[model samples]
Target chain A: MELVVVSVLGADRVGIVAGIASVLARHNANIVDISQTVVRDIFSMIMVVDISKADVDISQLRRELEEEGKRLGVMVGVFHIDVFKYMQRI
Target chain B: MRFDPREIGEVLEMLVFRELDIRAVTLSVNTLPAIRPNLKDALDALSHLLEPYARRLRPAAEKVASKLGVRIVTVRLAVSPTSIMLEPLGDAKAAVEIAAFLDELAGRHGVDMVGGFSAFVHGGVSRGAAALIEGLAEALNSTERVAGFLNAASTMTGINLEAVRRAARIVLSLKPHAAARFAVTANLPEDVPFMPGAYHGLGQPDAVVNIAVSGPGVIEAVVRSLPDADVRTLHDAIKRAAFKITRLGELVGREVAKELGVAFGAVDLSVAPSPKVGDSVAAVLEAMGLPRVGAPGSVFALALFTDAVKKGGAMAASTIGGLSGAFIPVSEDAVMSQAAAEGAITLDGLKAMAAVCNTGLDMVGIPADVGPDVVAAIIADVMALAVHLDKPLGVRLIPVPGARPGDIYDLGGLYGRVAVVDASRYSKIPLVARPGTAPPGVERLKKG
Candidate 1:
């Protein structure tokens, strides 16, 4: 499976998740898992999305998500899931 | 979440906020095969051999970096030490010509820098080594993208004071910011992905990709997160951070090497720092509760930091190479430069720190008027330490033009700002003028 870990971090707001989810949905990327938290009073969202079926490539999806994230006043990063596995896993 | 939210969040925080990134992805290309008896043929062969690899480097690095979302700064190329390549030609002018060609090649192909204009003269200077050393000033001065290293001292070969003197003289002749691109090294590693020390060893395969990881900011954040933690706990925290950083380096190196159709070499676990405000090894020490970087407990803090990183990196990567200790480049790290500017750190203090650190006397700016003898003496001091310690160390001194002690030279952009530190107290030393290789350290005499 071509999985990606998309993370968003910024000030707390209403449309941050909606803005990101819509972009992923429009690209046909399926969100498999999501977890949001307010750590140190800063809002952060982590989403594992299956990008294999996406209409756009990872770069295009990243750009759209980032643009939407900027509109929602957050910083968004899209990385292949292996980045996490390689770093965090034994 | 597929993984723990905290784990994902931590990785993001390190990447996004903590200034963590792969410092360099250096492709080590063996250029010995390109050497020909004729200078023109040699240049042609070298050009043909390296151009394709150089051309692919940036794109491959970018492809891996974009896919992994880990920024790989500075895609560099390291070749076999130019002295060896130019030896057969027996022409001093050939060094400058080759340097210019390599500089152009690097620039045209989007390679950030090209290393390995180097000579291994730890024992004695050969005709080829002498030629390379002779043309070093001109070659480095004229070339923007080429970096050079002179291994004047090593554990097995001892300290070559004559070679050190020659290197210092070359440093004196270099133009502004040119000194930043060259180094006089002791026990220079063949596969360190950092310049101006990287070189393809004779032992290495035709090509390999080595990664240098920079994460002083990430480690500092880890240290800062444990404000009241015990000493061992603090060490463990640092280890965990270093593990992740090395893993990132390994991943990037493997992917880039695969993309370029080369072998993955090793990850240099050096916690290299940039000139950015938060990205500093000194800051990491400060975060470990030092009132300032050069405060009393600084050495102990650095030792602890480096040891933990080595341990973490050892566990994380299959093969760890290069200068795996934390780098304390004065100008390139904002805090260290500030410490130097504030008189919190002196040349002697930095030398003391280098006793335990990876690189020695790096990117330090001294008074412009300081004689070659003084610089030679300093290089000799560093060489002596490296010989005794049997470790890798390098000295990159910038003799800022017309600058005095306490004056700040703003070289700007990655080379960063340098505060001129005093080296005049040792200026009268005539020991370096005594031309001979010093005997190896006591470690060499040890028997199993």
Candidate 2:
């Protein structure tokens, strides 16, 4: 309930950020932190969202983000924070 | 704790895109109190007693997995073995009733399986044990969720030829649909999560939770990235990947256990494979540079992978029970099935690899014409390997009636598909291998 990890990756294109943000906002998952960059025309972004007050379940948010990602020709992934802490720590 | 985006992104990739999952979370419950005679008076009391213990099982598991974005393949239960509970009744009819009762509980809770409709007869068999074994096919055939196993051999006990033969005949008699629900195991641990072999051993706590973690796709990705690395680096990479995968299981398992107020038993670090392309253990082996799973250099490939998995997983979890190694179940794995389909991996080769890996001749499909004696022989050979090597092993062979070797035997879904595998030419063997009169080290080993 504290925060969820959301990552997006694909070719740099128009409205990728707005598209992702609008969907997240609509679900009431407030973005606590955001980082985005375009390297060699392939765009990558990571957002830390606080979903303690989100309007939808994590699975529903994931489904919507995936659909928007498809429309934007990108791949979106939403995962629990434990995945990050366990795999990256040791 | 906040995590760096790049580090977290990599983990998200593994979870979201790589098919990582907590394969199963099994709740081992105590059903001893419900063991009563099959009378009108007892059936009503038994259901009332079992209802409260399992009432929240499925919901608790689902809530926890959903909150964490973890995909839990199944929620199952392992009760006290049925043979002991029905021993006093000495009625096969009562045993069948118990099996149906358990399965009904599972259906109501939407649980995937309920194991421990089983008997351990390596030491000796009794009248009730015989009744359960003879009634096994009927019990399993009648229930969708019931699972049964016959542990006929153990490392310390040598082998029980009689039990092995009886188990083989029972397997042949099972309704084709019941094949997936029954297993013949050797040297199984107390807290394994795989079915249809999982049962709560006498030593286990009354209400413990065991987690079976599977991530073949994640492991294959690691091996694929280090294509040219030497043996040392490859081993290290595998260890690192296994550590991460098993840690996920421990974390999720502990949380689920805590939420359910049950004792956390162990993290079973078995790398489960399915028919899916990337999820096969054989695919992970192929990623390690073998052309295919059964080609030259395949056995050593499995040896390396299995050892590294155990080494790495042990570092992550405090208690690792179950079959904690890479499983090579044919029909359940695409590469293994393909290897059998092409005749690249023979049944003998499977036995040889079984010595080095976790299980023996697992999920193997043989010719429909093969007799019960031959099937019993194969199982006995596997039993011997487990006792000699001091490892836990199981046999889940499928005798696909009307299907010849190399033909596709499709059981469908998670039971998967297997190409019928050719066995060594059968030779006549005694119905029960004559027991040795007085083996030298047997008593001392049993005592120790």
Candidate 3:
């Protein structure tokens, strides 16, 4: 299955996770794993999802997350897992 | 194995916060095939051979850098030295033409600078070497992208005092802004960085991909976080930090080399700093509790820092080569420049630092009216250390014509702003002290 990492970072706010999940559900993406933390009062989250059965492609999902993130006052990004894998291989 | 979120977070922190990067990705393209008797034929051969390679390098470099989230400071191309070409070409004009052509090719290919406008003249001055040295002034003045040097001293060859004098005279006479693009080295390496000294040495492949990794800011961050740590703890922290930093270079460098279809060369293990704030190597010293660089124990700090980095980088890179030590460029590193401005770092102190670091007297400025003999004296001092100790050393002296000590010369971008240093009371060596036999390194090279 094709996997992607989606991240959101900003100050603490309400409904950020639900709002992100709402978009993923509409696109038929399976949220395989999720992790969140608050460091120095900044909210950072990372979600790994299976994109094999998604209705929309990664680019479109990234655009949607970016638009939604702007409205929610958060910074959002999407990336392939290969980059992280290369670093963690040792 | 399943990946962890913390691993991703750690990389993101280094990329976003620490500003880790690959400083330079140099592509060495062979121009030995282009050396010829006729000037036009040589130029034609070079353009034909180099055009396609140059065209593809920048695009591939940019694509790889962006996709991997690694910022590449510059993409450079090093050619084989042009000194060998000057012999059959008949005149220095061909040398000038070749330099200009290299400049044009670099401009067209979006290569930042084209190195190896160089002469390996340590066997005293040959006819071809003399022609290159004679043409150096005009060629550097005429071409923006061309960088040149003369390796006139070595551990085996001792020192080429005559050629050294010529290089010194060339600098004092021309005062070419591009003099910063040239250097004189002793015991120079086949592969190295912090140019004007980096050249694709003889017998290396036509095209090789090498990387110079930089992360002075990251080193500073580690030292800062360990405020009260003892020397042992501090050393461990820097090693851990440099291991990660050089790992990024190795991974990305290997990928870049694979994509470009060239041999993967070394990752220069240096924490080269830029003019950007918070990116200075001197800042690392300050973070280690020194009020300023050149203070007491400063050189010791630099030595330990460099040694630890080398140890860590050696562990990480597939093959660690190209100046596996620290870079102490004054103008390029903001903290270094500041120290110079405040008179905390002296020229002599920097000369001492160069002995321990990878390069020598780099980006140092001097008064415009300094005599050639004085320049020769300064180079002589550094070259002596390089030859005696057997290390790669390059002297990039900027002599500001008619300027005096404490005057600042603003060389924008990577070269940065440099304050003219006091080189007034220099030794007067009126004659080239020629010896009966060649230096030690040359004898070994011959026997080998």
lDDT of 2 at A83: 61
Expressed as tens digits, the lDDT of each residue in B267-324 for candidate 3 is: 8888788888878899998899889997877888888898889988888888887778
Output per-candidate TM-scores for chain A, rounded to 2 decimals.
0.93, 0.93, 0.93
lDDT of each: 0.89, 0.82, 0.81
Deviation in Å, model 1, residue B239 alpha carbon: 0.9
Kindly provide the TM-score of model 3 when superposed on the true structure, using C-alpha atoms: 0.91
The interface root-mean-square deviation of each model, in the order shown, is 0.8, 1.9, 3.0
DockQ of each: 0.83, 0.56, 0.37
Q: Pick out the ten consecutive residues of candidate 3 chain B with the lowest summed lDDT.
A: B434-443
Q: For model 2, give the interface RMSD.
A: 1.9
lDDT (10s digit) by residue, model 1, range B123-172 = 99887887898889999999998999999988886888889889989888
TM-score winner between candidates 2 and 3: 2
Better of 2 and 3 by lDDT: 2
By DockQ, is 2 or 3 better? 2
- Judging by DockQ against the true structure, name the best candidate: 1
Q: Which ten residues in a row have the lowest lDDT in candidate 2 chain A?
A: A81-90
Q: Which stretches of candidate 2 lie over 4 Å from their true place?
A: A9-13, A23-30, A37-43, A52-75, B39-42, B431-447
Q: Candidate 2 at residue B321, lDDT?
A: 90
Q: Quick one: ranking by lDDT, best first? A: 1, 2, 3
